[model samples]
Structures are given as C-alpha cells and as structure tokens.
Target: MQSFRDEIENPIVQKEIIDLEKKIYSFRNGQIDDERFRSLRLARGIYGQRQEGVQMIRIKLPYGKVSSEQLKRITEVSDKYSTGRLHITTRQDIQIHYVSLDRTPELWADLAKDDITLREACGNTVRNITGSELAGVDVDEPFDITPYAHGLFQYLLRNPICQEMGRKFKISFSSSEKDSALSYLHDLGFIPKIVNGEKGFKIMLGGGLGSQPSHAELLSEFVPVNQIIPTAEGVIRVFDRHGERAKRLKARLKFLIKDLGRDEFLRLVDEEKKALPFHSYEIETAAFEGPITEPLLAVPSVTIDDVEAFEAWKKSNVIAQKQAGYVAIGIKVSLGDFYTDKARVLADLIKNYGANELRFSLRQNIVIRNIKEENLAFFYQELAKLDFVTLGYNTIGDVTACPGTDTCNLGIASSTGIATELERVLATEYPQYADNTGISIKISGCMNACGQHNMSEIGFQGMSINSGKLVAPALQVLLGGGILGDGKGRFSDKVIKIPSRRGPDALRYILNDFEANANGQSFLNYYDAKGEKYFYDFLLPLSDVTNLTEEDFVDWGNADNYVKAVGVGECAGVVIDLVATLLFEAKDKLTFSHEALQEGKWSDSIYLTYAGFVNGAKALLLAEGQKTNTHAGIIDLFDTVFVETNKIELSSSFKDLVYQINKKEPSEAFAKAYIQEGVAFFENIENYRAKDLANA
Candidate 1:
C-alpha cells in the first residue's frame, strides 16, 4: 500500500487510497463495526460476492466510454488482482470478480494511472452516470450529449451531498428522443433537445426499476444544459434529507416520490435552491464539438471465405454514423462476458483500424466507432478472427442477463444459464429474429432488477417453486415492457412461472404465438392488443408441476438438484447503528467538514457539519434503544428523548440547531460557524456518553 501511494501522483487521490488501506487494516483487526466496514468498502467499489472472502470490483466508466489505453489498463489490473474475465453491467461499467479485499487500494491506484476510477461506483451514492453509446454519432440526435454527461459525472463523483444517501441514485442521458439510455427508469433522466436553436434537455425525475417499477415524472420539459447540474443537485439534497433509511425496500427515490406526491417533491427541491453551491453549472461543450480529422490511410486487403456470412454480418452488425464515410460496428458480447486475451486483441484492432475509443452499450454490448466504410471487409475478417463478428448486435438474439447464482448473493436461480439456453434457441430455431431489433429479452437472478428485466419487451426473473418436499429453480415470465421514447415507458407484467429447464420452450411458445397472430404489429402493440390474460391462458400449461420429469429438478448449468439459498444483498449499504461506531463516525464527519472548509467549498462544509450534528444526536438516541429512521425523525426524536427530557443539556432544541442548514444560505461565514457548533456539540456528546458509560 505504501509503495502504491508513492507511485500515485495526485495528492487527493493518493490520500483517498491510503485512507482506504488504513480502513481495511482496521476492519481486519476488528476495530470497525461489520456494517460500518461494509458501507466503507462499498463506497470504494469493493463489493462482497456470493462466495465468502472475495469481492467484485465495479469499475465506473462515465457514459461507458473507454479509450484503448484505458481498456489495456483495465485488462492489466484484472489480470493482476482478479480473474481475467470482465463482465459489463447494464449501466455500462465493467465488473471483475473474485478479488481480494486487501488489495483493492492497490488495484485502484493502478487504474488511476490511466485516468480510470472506482470511487462511488457502488453503495448508497450516485452510481455510474450512463448514457447512449450513440450520443455523438447517432443520425437522429439534435446535438452531442457526451460533454454534458461527462460534466455531470465529474460534478457529482465525490460531492458531499450525495456520498451517503438513503439509497442508491441512478442518472442517465439519452442522445435523442429514441431514448436508447432508457430514460424512464432512472432517478434522473435527461433527453437532449434543441428548442429554438438553443441547447436544452427534458428532465425526468424519480423513476426506478425493482420489484415495483415506477415511471419517472417529467420534472421539466426543457432546462438549458447549463442548469442540469444544479437541478440534479437540488433533487439529490431533497432525497438525502427525506428519503427512508430504516426500511430497505422503501428507501429508493421512487418510493419517496410516491410517498410525497410529485408536486410536493418538486416543492422540496425548490426549497433547496438557497443552499446550493451553484445556480447553474455551464458545461464545457467545445471539447466534444469537432469533426473527424483522421488521415486517409491505405486500406488493408483481406479475403472472406464465407461471402454470404460476411454480408449477413455487415447487414446486422454495421451501423451508420453521423459522420460521413464512417460507421460503427457492434460486438454482441455473449451474456456480457469477455476474457482479457480477446479484449486486448480487440483493443489493438480498434486502435489501429478504427477509432481508439469504444463505448459499452446499455444492453451489455460493445460499439466500436469511427471505422471507415471502405474497410468493412478487412475489419470483418479481422473481427472474425476474434470470433466477434456475430450476426446479431442488438436484436432478440442478444440477451441481457445478470450473474445470478453464479456470483450474486441475492440470486435464487441461474439467470445466465437460462439466458444462454434461450439465446441458443433463438439462434437455432428462429434465425429471422437475428436482425429483428424490435424485440428485447432480459433476465435477472432476482426481483432487484439488476439485469433490468422489468423494463424489457420480454423479461424473466429468477425464483423457486416448491412441489411437495422438493424445490426447483423457477422463472417468472413477463411481457409488454419497452421504452416509449421521451421519458415514458411501461413495466412488464408478470405473466407466468415455469421451471428453469422449461425456459426455452416458453420462449418458443411466445414467439410462435406472436408470429401466427401478431399480423405486422410491434411486440409492445401486440401485447397491448392481446392483453395479459390472453397470453397467460396459452402459456399457463407450462407452469404445471405434476408432469415434471427428473431433469426438471436440476436447474440450468447445474448437474445436481436445485437448492434455494439466498444471502443478504449489499447493493444498498447496510445500516450502521452501533452506538460507539456512530459517535466515532460523527467525529470523522467533523474532520471532513474541516477539510471541505479549508478547500473553500462552503456548501459542502455546511452539509458535512449538519450531518455531524445529526449523527452525534442519533448516537445518544440509539444508546437509549430509540428507533432512528429518517434525518428529520432523528432530529425530532433527539429533541424529544434528550432535550425535552433534560437527559442531555443543549443551548437550544436539536431541530432548531440542525434545521439552520435549510433556513440559512450556505455562506462561508455560516459554514465556519456551523463547523464550530458541530465541534462543540461533539465534545458535549462525547463527554456525556463517556460519563454515562462509566456509570453503567
């Protein structure tokens, strides 16, 4: 760790890596609480896997953009610290599994050399900012949204307001009205629009996909690009202060929007305006506005053995770019899994033959941009050598799935196994759908929707079905979910549940029925016309358990009989309620407050000081076995249990003391005074607690 620290040149990042190393050491020595350590490691992007004593590190990539150099750097780090296999997530980040927790700081330091990061990639913070891979080159886009997406990600990566929220927050940017980024299913979604020749965006708020999927409400029809950051910050502040903390299931921003109507929720966001650090953040767009300047180099010559197959590949996998004479090629990664050796080869191919950059698509596929149109045959032959020139790019044959029971703690069934079999079924039985991009299939190990199963045209969620004394892996079939463009969409309805081995037959039945009766309608339109019960009646026969064979008891990709074992999920970091740990965290908050104050970030310092007060008061409340849920609840309860009861003396009511954050403007004078007050409050609480503990 010390050697890596010396190699890292950025002082701020070096300090962060060193701090993580220290925290890991303390946690290993049992000096930190289990829940506290879980939260800490998750914030740094080290996640616990289904198997013990190993981790899954999520490498956050803004808008899923990666250059050739960065790709090589990632491959190198994966080879050193983890398995050589990389898994692309739905949000366009790369995940490497089976990593040792002790080496995370070193791994992070190495990636930092290539300008990559793992900070705030997981836990209750704002996750990786996602957008369309076609942002700059899509034919239908009004303007490029790359710089704006990049701008927002930079502003919020380590913002104090979003570091510790009630639940994870997701944000997305779409290139155009096509909404390729799935704007309707994020906490905040932005769709680029040019109104009166001015650059602006239509914002969607409070949308999420889980067991209960919710469509985002339109927060604004148009806000200038300069105001997007401030608008997002305001919404995050409201969520941090008011979102549920005690109930894990009810902690997302969507639930908060449901509890408080959209009107009231927006009103709270408006109330946070005074405390915001900026009224509008102007995104620097000039860097993204440019034309291709590649020299006209000599094209390489190659021969294609299978002309028919090559033509089919060109028809399906090749995409037209907004830039003339250039095209983007899509690589349909099977189950979003790719090994390091092929990745290195692919990176070199793109660097030499095409643009040095690649963007991971939202569907867990790779899009290589800036390939000259004239060199199609040569590039095809090269890609065919890597076995990457598959016929389908983003069609029904390209399935999106999560690593269900394979590595996820919450997985009850094998999502990847069933997904693979289904993909094979589509390839062998329904070849016509290979280029049919209208329909989509997605699967998740469980109801958490990590695979985004709830928001696809056809979806499957992992589950288990019990018959007498035996249990088998099961899948809940769903229908009628798709993007409706411009921040509107529908969530799939649960249609039926069938054994995992029967998944391929279920897909065959659905597709066969659609082909016979749909009569040229889109999949979503046909599902709407037929209604839920119409398909349920036809597919219900597969749900029968009495006719089960012995093979039905064994799940997909497994040789033994199925056994259901679900572990605690850490997607939303665990709540830490230990009294001593809470008090210690309060002191840590003050240290952070002083750092922010010294850096001249007034709003950040104020919020950190405010959090310190709440944490200190909550520590005393928890010492008495009181329930502390929301920040507002903690303030009121602290006043009730401590101030009003005179158990702990204070200059004023706790609510009056802490509520000053919202009531007063975030000026440097106010921030300094707030830090001082927090210092005094901590000293009082620590002394009182020490006396109380001594007496007990």
Candidate 2:
C-alpha cells in the first residue's frame, strides 16, 4: 500500500488518498464524528452498505466510457479490494461491494494508476456525469456529446462549489433530440441542437426522480457550446446558497426551484454570472472524435456451431454506427451484475479485435463500439464464450434492476430477484418482445428509485405488506411512463401493490392484457388509451394478500422468512450539527483554500475561503443555539448574533465578509487576500469559542 501511495503521480490525488487514510485512522480511534466521517468517505466514493463494517466503492467512469486498460485495472482492484464482481449503475458508474474502509485509500491509489477515479461518485457532490451510450455513433445525433460531458466532469471534480452542497447534483447529456440519456430526469440535462449551423444544446433544469419525481423545466431554448460551464456554475451557486439543508428529502435542486419560482431561480443564476471564472469555456472535442485506438491484433477467425442462436444474438445486440461500415455491440448484463473474470476477457477482446473503448449504458448494459461489419461473427463467437451474447440487449427482456435487499440499505424487498423472474417470464412466454424496444421495464428496491423505475413503461418499486403480525415482501406496480424525446418524459403512475411471489403473475397479466386489447398501438399509447384504472382493475386479483402462503412470506432469492430490515440510508451524507466538528471542518476548509491558492485555482481558492468563513460562523451560531440551514442564512445570522452584539470583532459585518466571494472576480489578488482573511477569522472564532467554553 505504501509503495503504491508513493507511486501515485498526481500530487493532488495522492494528497487526497493520504488524507482519507488519516481520516480513516482518526475515525477508527474515535477522534472523528461518525456523520462527519461518512461525509468525507462518501465524497471519495466510498459508500456504506446495508451490511456492517463494509463499503461499496463506486468507480466514477465519466459518461460510462472505459478504455481496455482501465477495465483491466478495475477488475484487478475488484479482485483485490472487493468481491470479484462489478455492478454497473444506471448512472453509468461501476460499483464494487464489501470493501474494507481501511483499505479504500490503497484501492483508490491502484485505480488512479489507470486514470479511473472513485471521487464524487457518491455524496452531496456532483456525481459522475452520464451521457447517451450511443453519443458518438448515433445516426440521428447532430454531434457527439462525449467531449462536453468529459469537459464538465473535469471542471466540477473537486471544485469547491458542489463539494458540500445540500444534496447531490446530477447532470446528463443526450446525443440528440431522441433524448436517449433521459434528460427530463436530471438536475441539468442537455440535448444536442444545431441552431443555424452553430452547435449548442437545449437546456433542461431541476429534473429528478425519487419518492417525489419532478419533471425538468426548460431553462433555455438554446445555450451556446462554450457557455455551458458558466451556466452550470451559476445554477450550482444559487442551489448551494438557498437549497434546503435540514430536510434531506427536500434538499435537491428540484425542490429549491419549486420553493423559489423558476423566474426567481433564474434571476439568482443570472446574478451569479458576474462571479463566474469563465464566461465562455471552449471545449476541445477533437481528441474524442475518432477511433480511440486501432486493433493491435487481427480478428480471430471463428465458426458458429449454433447458427440460429448466433443470428438471434446479432439481431438484438448489433447496432450500426454513424461512421460508415462500423457497428457497436451491446451486452445485456442481467441486473447490472457481471463477474471480474469475464470483464478481463472483454477488455482484451475489445483491445485486440476492435477499438479499445466501450461504454456502460444507462440501462446497466455494456456497449462495445467501433467493430468492423465483417468482424461481427468473430466478436460474437468470442462473447459467446463468456455468455455475453444474450438475445435481448435493450429490449423488453433486458430488465433493469437495483441490488435491492441484496446490498442496498433502503431496500424494502428483492428487486433483482423479481427482475430475474420477470425476464424469464418474458423470454419464455413472450419471445417476440426480445426485438421490441418500445416497452421498457425497470425495478427499484425502494422509492429512492436507483434503478430508474419511474420512467419506464412498466415499473415496480420494492415494498412490504403487513398481514397482522407477519410481513411479506411486496412490489408496487406502476405503468404508463415513457420518454417523449427532446427533454420531455412522464413519470409512471402507481397502479397496485402485490406480494413479491406474485410479481411474475402481475407481469403476465399486464402483457396478456396489452396483447389482447392494444390493437397494434405503442405500449405507452396503449397504456394511456386504456388508462391507469383499467390496468389496475385487471391486476387487482394479484394484489390480494388475504390468502398468502408460507412461500409468499419468503422473498425471492432468500430461504428465510422476510423481515423488514432497513438500515439508515447514506444516499445523501448525514447532517452534522456538532459545533466542534464544524469548527474542525472550518480549519480543514482553510487548509484547502491555501492549497488551491498554491495551485493557482483562483475561483476554487476563493470559494474555499468563503466556505471556511461560513463554516466558522455556523459553528459559533450553532453554539448559540441558532439555526444555520443555508449558507446565505448562516452569513446573515452570524452578523446578528455575534458581530452586531459585539461578541466578535471583524473588519466588516459577517455578511459583507462572506459575501465578498460573489462581489468580486476570482482574481489571484482577491483569492490570496480572501484566504489570508479566512485563516485569521478561524483563529478569532477558535479563541472566542475557547473563552465561551471556559465561562460555561
């Protein structure tokens, strides 16, 4: 571990790992607060799982793009640090479960060697930027969104504005108006648009799905390519200032936009423009345009023993790219779970026979790109060895599901268990759906909707039914949800709830009904024509829990009877109001401010200094039993409680001192001065707190 830590080339990343190690030691020794430690670890992409004393480390793969070398490196780390399995998230990141907290830093160092990161994959920070899997190859796309997604990810990583926001932020880029990335459900979603030959995007803001799904509103008809960073920065600034902090469920950007009207929110974003570091940040797209790398080894000659199976696989998995004579191959990773050994083979296969890059799709599948038309059979034969040549790639049989009770803390029932059963039902009963992409099915462990159940034509949310003193795992059936393209979509309506064992029957009923009455309409249109109540009427019998047997009490994939065991969810980092911890965090912020100044990140340095000031003030405010719910509120309250009362002395009012961040540009001179002042302010706050403690 020490050897790899020494070998880490990036000074910033090395320091981050070292700091994580030190923090872990502190946490183990009872020197750090549990909530504070959770926040720190989550920012580094180490998340707490349902099981005790283990973690799920999410490896951030920007836009789901992974090179052959990076894939090999991930497999190596997974084999060493976690279970030899990888779970592809709906957001296009890879997660490995059951990692020890103590060894996370070393594991991170290993992944960093291949330029793969775990940073910001979880926590109240800007998460991995997801994009359409077919961004570069889509025939209908105006231009590829790969570079923009990559550029935005690079800009926001470890950036001060989003690091400590009230809640996590999500961003997505769709390749075209097709909205394949599901733009309507992201905090900030972009769809490629060419306005009079100038490349730009139609911006959608404040979209999210959870217990309360909110459709994104149009932020702008068009934003030029270069102005995206500035736009994102402004929106984040406003969200950070006024987003809900005390209420975890209401802390998302969508809720903020809802509380403050869109007009007022846009006004706040406009106000933040003066303080932005860049008015127009041009992205370099050339590097992402062509083939990542030519195949080093020739395509192996192969013969298919089962020609019928091979043809069926190719019909669903093969996707033609916009580039002439090239295609992309899709691998249907069931429930997003794949072993590391198969992943190693896939890495080598892509490197040797095709372009050395592949993307993990938003539906938790793999897409290998740049394969030659003539080489399809060979690639298919190679994939068949690993059992990757499934019949349905993105079709109805390709059910998307979260880990559910298998790993997630908030799971009420088994999602993967039911999803697997439903997929089997589709393959056996409705084989024709394998080539149909019109109807999509998704499942979530709970209402948090990690599997994105709310935006599919058929959806199920994990739930539980109480039968007097006994409990049975159950699922909530939802219907009529579909994306309408161009940053528009509808959330599924909850239809009925049934026992987990009855999930297969529920799907059978729905499919049978659709087939009988649909009259050749699209699934969404058919669902709408019949209405939500119509489906509920037919599926009502399956919801009966009065006659549940012993088998109904046992959840799918479990031998024991179902017990509703839910751990405290760490989806958003816990809120810590400890005065001492806040003071300690203030000092840490000051240190980061000095480091950012040394690195010449003026905007970052200035923001860090501002955060330091706010944190120090909030510590004293909390000591006085005052509320510090938002940064703006903290600034105002600190002045009234301390500065005006003459309890603390400052050169100016606390509001003026902290508000200097947005009043001036992020120049080197201002950053240095702000950091120096922040350091002094920390000293003063510490002295005041000590005296107050002595008096008490």
Candidate 3:
C-alpha cells in the first residue's frame, strides 16, 4: 500500500499522518497503552464505536463550509471506507460510521485532497470552530464573520496550547445579535457588533451544555475585531493553566469559571495578554468577500402540481441574503443523515445552479447560498427530485437529534429513533406547524448533549426508568430552553420523565396545550407565562409507569425489548495515569518547549514548559494515588507531597515554580529559564519513579 507520507504534499500534515500510522501500529502491537492510544486516535478524530473494532471518523469542516467538490469528495471517501452514509453533527462536522480502524489514515488522506481535515475534531482539544451557517449572507450581520471565524480556526488548529487540554473546548461566531449560531452555549461565543462603524464582537465565555448546562457569562460587551485572536489566546491560556482535569464532568471551562468566580477568571485572562503572540491579530477579509458571479439567467417557467406546498416550502426554507438578487436555500436533512447518492446529486445541483459553496447548519442541515432569485423554482424542482426539499427548515417540525444507540457509546436510548417519530407526528398530525418557526425541538441520547437538547425550546434527554424490577428506556422531557440572542440563553428544565415509547404522545399533549392556550405567542413567551410547574402538571400523567403496556417497554424504532446498555464514552477521551507514560509526556512537552523557544515563540515555550511541570507532578501524584484535579491543585499537592516532604528537593515551592509564568513577561530570558525548570522537573520525577519501581 502507498503510504500517506509520499502522497501528502504539506510536510507538517505528512508528519502528522506518519506519526498517526506509527502510533496506530504501536497500539495494535500493544506497544502503546490502551488509554494513551485512545486519546491519540480521538485527537485525530478517529473515535471508537459501541461495536468494537470499527471507528467513527469525524470530518472537521470549519464553520460547516464545504464546496461542491469537497462534498463530492466526502461522498466518495464515505462510499469507499464505510457505509455510504454521512452524519452531520450539531457542531457542523460530518461523521462516517462503521469504518475499519486500519483504513482511517487512508480515509483522512483522501479527504485532505479536497482540503478537508479530521484533526482535533474530537478529544480534549478545541473541537470544530462553528459559526453562523449564513454568516457571509445574513442580512442582519454588521459584517461577514466568515473570515474571522476561519482565521481563528486556522490559528488554533494543531496549535500546541490546546492539543492536550483537560477537556474539549468549543467556540462559535454568530452573524448577528440574533445568535443563530447558538453562541450562548459555547466556551467562547462571538457576536458581530459595530462600534462607530468599526467591526467588533461581543464575547461570551464559559458557556456549555452537558448533564449540567450553564449559560456563558458575558466576558466583554465589545472587543475590537483585531483583538479577537489575541483575546481568545489569552482565554485559552488561562483555561489550560487552571481548568479541571481529574473529574470528567467538572472539567469544562464553565465549571472552572464557576469555581473561580467570573471576576477571577477574567482577571486571569487579562493577565495572560502579555504572553499572547500578537496584541492585535487583524484578520484579512479579502478571502471571504462576496464573490462576483455572472448575471442570473431568466426564470424558467415550471408547471407546479402543488402551488400551496411549493409556497410553504419557499416561506420556510428560503432565506433572503444581504446580497441583492440572490437567496440562500435551507435543506432540512432529517436527523442529519443522508445517503451518498443524494449527496452527490445535491452537490452537482449546487455547483451547476447555485454557488459552488454550501454550509452545514448547527441544526444538522445544509444551506446552499448565492442562488439567483430567479432559480428558486428550478432549484426546488431539482432538490425535490432528490427528496431534499423539506418545508420546515428551523421550525418545530425540523428536529435535531444525535445518533444515540445507533452508534454513540454513551446513548441510553435511541435518540434518532424518537426524533424521527416526533418529526412524523408533526408532519402527519400537526401539519399546521409546517412553517411555524416559533419553537425548536432537539434530542440527545445521553446527558452529554451532543444533540444540544439543553438549548432547544423543547428537549428530550435519554434516560432509563426503573419499574419494580424492570428498567426500561425513558425520555427526560424538558421545556422552556432556548437562545435569547446576543450571548443569552436558558437551559431547559426537566419537566417530566416518561417511557421512550410515549415520547410522541408527550409531544402531542404539549403541542395541543400550547396551540389551545398560547394565543399565537412564541413558544418561549408562552412557556414563560405558563411557568415550569404548569407544564409539569399538564404532562404529569405521562410519567405514570404503572399504565405502561408491553409496547411501552420497547424503545422507539426497536421491536424488541429495550435494554439500557451504555458503553464507555469517548467524547472526552481517556485519562491515562500510567507513570511512565505521564513522565514520557512531560519529557515530550519539555522537547516541545525547546522547539517553541527556537521558533521565537516565547509564550508558547513558557506554556509548554508549564504543561511539562504539571504532567511531571501529576505522575508523582498519581504514583501516590493522590487526586490531581486541576493544574493549581497539582502544583499545590506536589509541593506538599513531594517537595515539602523532602521526597524531592526543589529550590522553591512547586506553585511558585509553575506559577512564575503568570508573574513574568514571556521574554526570552524567562522562557529559557522555564524550559530549564521543566527539564529539571521531568528528570526529578523520572528518578523518583525509577527509585520507587526499584523498591517495588
């Protein structure tokens, strides 16, 4: 087989591929630890599935933008490597499942030919940087944030700082204050703003959705456009320095900010500014500027069999672009899964009729932009032929769901199953809501919220109910959660838990009540007026397990009895506490610090060295079976357990040694000294571990 090393042109990418191949070989041969291997593969977007030996490859498309060529390329790769099915995630990445682990490198190489990447798509690194799907063309946007979002993604991808963080970090950009990108649920949310006609962004920090959802705090009302990168770097640096590590659930930036208090967190962020590579990294928007296209051809007169159906589709699916004489079309990808054959047809249709570029929305749908106004009928007809013309683009009928038991290891129930059923209920029973954009529905198989259920107007989280000795699949129905725009949102309140089979009935009851009493108000307004208790009271009967028939025990889309089987989750990767591995990683960080110093990256060198110190200390702490939760905690515990106890001697406290990065400017002198400190720390830990092993 031809190696990717020869096929890939970029030296850096080639080296990355070669390294992955080497690591995979080592892992397969048992030369690498299982936990360490899991982390490595996850960082490269090769995720383990519930069905062992197969992988789920997540292709990272920054801001969900994909050209016709790229989409076709993806389809080709999917067809060759796995099932001809493409799954779009809420973060706007595409995933292909049941892939052989050995073929991932080949699959990735094929993707890179079309400028697609899989790096950092998973694991405790910066996930795909998402932005408004309509960023460039949104009429409400002060300016196109496409360039800025792309710029940030470029700056952070494969950056040393976030390569191996405590947990995954998410960032998003909204085109306007409407926050269509759902900025409020991201780790760092950016909304475009204009200050005296100068571009800026209102920043939101530490927002996340998991089992426990917390709204992001407003980090800054407005920061100049040029400062976005630098400010983001500063925030990441702080997160790296202090974010929790030991506990998987509490490791998110939101928890860190909550624990430290927002004021302290911001202070730390401001303190890291001096170490930033650039004080103002101005983004060049030339690449993302509006493309010049040929004049639109005359509208083709087509006989419509159902004018009313076509009009409804137009009202819900077509969005007016800021660019005059053009529009954007939204294609509701049911449950975000589409076959490769249809994908190819859609790709060709967009390339021939519309702009060659398209973006996948956070709601797991596609938005084809720059379509000539006159081509709407023609485009609809072409799309209808492929069964891609769905009327409810972002309405309640358009449900977002994660691939729960179908693939996800953490899924307790079938999210996609229930989501499909609920969408059917809407289409067949509640057809009046075909164009109603007043509400949103989302589902997640687990509390990790991959489906982003916590931020939807109506949400369902997969759970299990214990009925006497029987445990059956259940849905935790939540209500009143949604984005309030401009870095504001609410987490859904769990109103009731019911059998998974009753999900459609539960939806019917809620919708029936809302339609009767809402008086044409939006779902959010009606929800607020009705209050949580009122809705809970209304849906209370659904929670009665005593009335469940044998069918109720069966999960959606499953004919057999539902079994609550949840495998290990790979979303956060694995925590490898092997002493040798930890020490080896510390040495690797020290080597990285030296490289950064040679490259004139003083701040990068300093931070790399800091990580070296933390890893080295964590090795010793793990040896003692001591808990190391955060970087701050590791430093403090190391001083007490090793340095102060005289098991290892140091010139100063471990806290002072590691925390020096915060006090001093990231000059060459300090960076050199810090690298030396890291080297000494690694050596000390190595010797201690060796001695301890000898004694054992």
Candidate 3 lDDT, tens digit per residue, 505-543?
A: 999999999989999888989999999999889888888
TM-score for candidate 3: 0.96
In order, candidate lDDTs are 0.91, 0.92, 0.89
Q: How close is candidate 2 to the true structure, as a TM-score?
A: 0.98
Using lDDT as the measure, which candidate wins?
A: 2
User: What residue runs in model 1 are displaced by over 4 Å at the alpha carbon?
Assistant: 293-299
Global lDDT of model 2: 0.92
Pairs with backbone N, CA or C atoms under 3 Å apart (clashes), candidate 3: none
Candidate 1: tens digits of C-alpha lDDT, residues 1-696: 458779887887899999999999999999997899999989999999999999999999999999888999999999999989999999999999999998999999999998899999999999999999988999999999999999999999888888888899999999999899988999999999999999999999999998989999999999999899989999999999888888989999999999999999999999888888889889998877776645334568877789999888889999999888898999999999998998999888777767678999998999988888888999898888888998889999999999999999999999999999999999999987878889999999999999999988999999999877799899999999998898889899999999888899999999999999999999999999999999899999999988888898898999999999999898888788888888988898999999999999999899999889988988898899998878888999988988898887888998888888888888999999999989998998999899999999
The global Cα lDDT (0 to 1) of model 1 is: 0.91
* Model 3, runs deviating above 4 Å: 293-308, 598-600, 667-673
TM-score of each: 0.98, 0.98, 0.96
lDDT tens readout by residue for model 2, 158-242: 8899998899999999999989998899999999999999999999999999999999999998999999999999999999988
- State how far residue 694 of model 3 sits from its true place (Å): 2.5
Candidates 1 and 3: which is better by TM-score? 1
Provide the lDDT at 270 for model 2.
91
Sorting all predicted structures by lDDT, with the top scorer first, yields: 2, 1, 3
**2 versus 3: better lDDT goes to:** 2
